[model samples]
Target: MTQPAFVAPGVVTAFCPKPTSHTGVVVMVAAKGDGVVVLDSGMAEPMPDALGPALELLGATTADVRAVLSTHGHRDHTGGSRALRDASGALTYFSADDEGLAGFAPDVPVTDGDVISSGDLRFEVVTTPGHTAGSVCFYEPTLKLLVAGDGVQGVGSARKLPVYYESGTRYRASLRKLLALEIDTLVVGHPLAWRGANTHVFTGAQCHELLEDSFAAAEAIRAAVAAVGPHPTPHRAALAVLATSPIFDHFDPGDPVEEDTEATLDSELRDLAGTAVR
Candidate 1:
């Protein structure tokens, strides 16, 4: 029984079970009716308990849900799709590029420039292939709100290690693309952090600052890859990065290494070699 709260007009935020501020969920209610839209479900089973509370926040119900937009194919984001759809019969959406992820099958395969409408909300999908091949952000121009799942990771989440499976080059480009948007509110899948501040929501200049910080962090990784060269042992290379990169905080070189960190380092190395292109 998670309590959902309004972060912006007509938009409610719910947290997945046992969530931190970094892993909050977003729900959008139609301005003209009871139609509801959920963005990025959750990571585990039984669906997110917050959904019911979110609907109540807007005076809506499961039957009023018209759409469920997944930011990417990551289970933490897409895991609740089937349950949500089963409950509300809402059309599910995710980038067709990510249909290959386990258990992902979007009712509407989304692409860049595609528009999804629910009630008065018209979300223009912006394809951002980085965190995952099909990572995307939904922007509603009228509200100036962008619901970016994992497409933008500042310095990573609570662990403070950014994760990107696809091309790091493309990830940086996606950050640049988001920086160009006219966004008043930015909602992300995790509490991505910058300089130790972490949250899933950003408003006004904080939005641009967060985008800039994310880009800068990605750029730092790129620079590290360039310095370390492409063939170094993955673990050693990651240690070298952790030792020198200011993008990471509260991390020590002696700490046990994370596989995703190593993977990101390898991906960046490939990017530097021009071999990571998707």
Candidate 2:
């Protein structure tokens, strides 16, 4: 298909592509002006078929891209980075902590509070680390748009709780930082882009409620693990807990479970806890 036209006046478009076995790849692209900045690049595959069309719509090409900004280092988000860099000769930008995961070291290592500007568009970095150690959210205050990676998904997807939290306490604090922003449009990585979802913006009050719920879910999972006794396999323990989490429950009641789902969940939790321990 011809690249989807730029959805917003200043924003260009492209698809993130399905990567992981679980979810479809999100549509990833850039919003360009004086400089070009790309969001996620999709899987660690070749340049997506839609990439050319999206760039064309912007009156640009991969060569015009100045920098690539990734919310985190997941394979799906960083997969196309190397190819894009080869194509556009653009510098990559990512959280310092995520350098190894994303493959390429960020030429521009973004820190919290860093402001990136391109002509009239400006993006402020918000360090939101619940999903991963270095996950971040890019906010364009003028447009009130938030490019939140996995920290928060679209309306129906479950928020990937920081399985690798350096500090559970700090991760929660970061969520508070996001909730405090004056966000009107939330452009998340997974699922579709959310526009004009103001009424659903989680307010400070609502955030606290969700935070508590998340913690409660975690605690229940933990409790179930404890009850399963010391020798319980991590995979089984996690599955038992996840089976009871309200977040998982919110989805369809009888969806078929992936054969390796429990194992994958265990691996993710281990990774998350390992980060916390370090």
Candidate 3:
């Protein structure tokens, strides 16, 4: 069980099953007295009880959970939705593009700018398709919170898969789309974005602050795609992109975690150190 921490006016975010300083997967709950909302259910069989613990942290559960909003179709974020929905009887929602992938269809098909309000809480869906064809982030204007499910990945290591992203152009557009929102608490699906220490989530000013790095990562990838061209060699093209990457710590998620992200960066620098000498 991940420790739940208060993030914004009506939000608490936690990394479940196990806790890691920089892992991107997380569960978030946003609530107000009359109703509650589970942003994303963790990867579990029965789907963890989102309300009891969420309200407990707030010193408040009535049978008033209004909905479960999934940011994308990825199993880690949406796996527990059906179970939670079955248990709480709350309405479940996700992007329509993900219906084929997530298995269980949502009660409400969410689209860009679609608003979901429960009592005093309101979340507006922003379509961000790079992470997945149907990936999205929810913005609570009142709470100034953004539930970014893998939308803005931490740069150190990323999961390379088609479901995660297909078009760099669409991905960059998605990042710019999110930059327009007003946010104080940003709950990323994973904490791929770096901090001094491995930090899974960003709260208050740090949310907006860390986005600078996230945006730069997007731009860097865009550049890589351009450099790769129409007929690029897979391995050489990838290494070339990594070489010119602005985000220094990019790696594959399946890559060994024992290797500290910084150490990989340092090794790259050491390899490049002799260039000036030569």
Candidate 4:
């Protein structure tokens, strides 16, 4: 399918073939005046059919793409990097801390507090390194939007935390950083925007609360794992604790747990990384 011309100012244009059981692929298109900044190229191999169509929505051909900014080095987020760069001659930007994950060096090595601009739109680089060593969120103060890669998601109050982190503690700290910002819209990586309704702009206090909740969940999972003796069942045990946590309780009932049982846990672990009993 042909991609669409850009729609909505400061809106991220998402593209993916089929939504996965747990996540989805999204490509954020940041309008820089008449130019465009493409954040994340979805999936590496067997490119999703929606990619072309999604780009087309913005009247962007691969050649028109000027820059590719990555949230981190995950395959799903960086999968299309090579293709997009090769096709568009666009420079790719990433945190200097994530040079190894890019599978190539970044042209623009982003640092915390650095401001990136395309046109009238500018994003302040907020380093959030919990989900990955180099994970970062782009805050458009003018837009009041937080482009939080994998640092946050709306999975459920009780869903299992994402794996693939270089430092869980760092990730938690990053969450706190995100919360400190005045944000009403959270444009996440795997999911679309979380806004509207009763979702109020997050204050420093609320951000701190979310970080505390995340830390508590992590601690609960750690305690469960320690008690379970490095077995597969620890995941389920952790999930149970997470489900009961106050954070999870904030959401409505019937939220999905991607890996709810031992069988699914093993599968998810394999998919995320080689089997490890963490």
Off by over 4 Å in 4: 1-8, 18-21, 24-27, 30-34, 46-49, 154-164, 192-236, 246-278
The 10 consecutive residues of candidate 3 with the worst lDDT sum are 156-165
Winning candidate number (TM-score): 1
Q: Write the per-residue lDDT of candidate 2 for residues 1-278, one digit (tens) a residue.
A: 12454545677656655745434555575888776778878776557444777777788777887777888887777778777777778877789888777766877899899988888888888988855778898888877777766665432343232233334444455766766777656665654212222222343344344434445544444454445544446555555556665555543323454443443344445545665579
- Of 2 and 4, the candidate ranking higher by lDDT: 2
lDDT for 139 in candidate 1 is 93
Error of 1 at 75 (Å): 1.0
Span of ten consecutive residues with least summed lDDT in model 4: 192-201
Off by over 4 Å in 1: 1-3, 18-34, 230-232, 275-278
Give all TM-scores, in the order shown.
0.88, 0.72, 0.77, 0.69
Q: What ranges in model 3 sit over 4 Å off?
A: 18-25, 50-52, 60-63, 158-164, 228-233, 240-246, 250-278
Q: Cα RMSD (Å) between model 3 and the true structure?
A: 8.1
Better of 3 and 4 by lDDT: 3
lDDT of 1 by residue, 1-278 (tens): 14566767888777675343223433322221347888877755647455677777788877777788888887777877888788879888999888887376899999999988866778899999988889999998888989888788776765446655577888989989998899998887766656667667789998998888788777877777776664537556656675677667644566556666777777887766665455
After best superposition, candidate 1 residue 193: deviation in angstroms?
A: 2.7
Model 4 residue 113 CA deviation (Å) reads 1.7
**Residue range 110-215, candidate 3, lDDT tens digits:** 9998998877777889999866688889988877888888787655434331113444456567878877777777877764536544555677777766666666
CA RMSD per model (angstroms): 3.3, 5.5, 8.1, 6.7
Q: State how far residue 94 of model 1 sits from its true place (Å).
A: 1.0
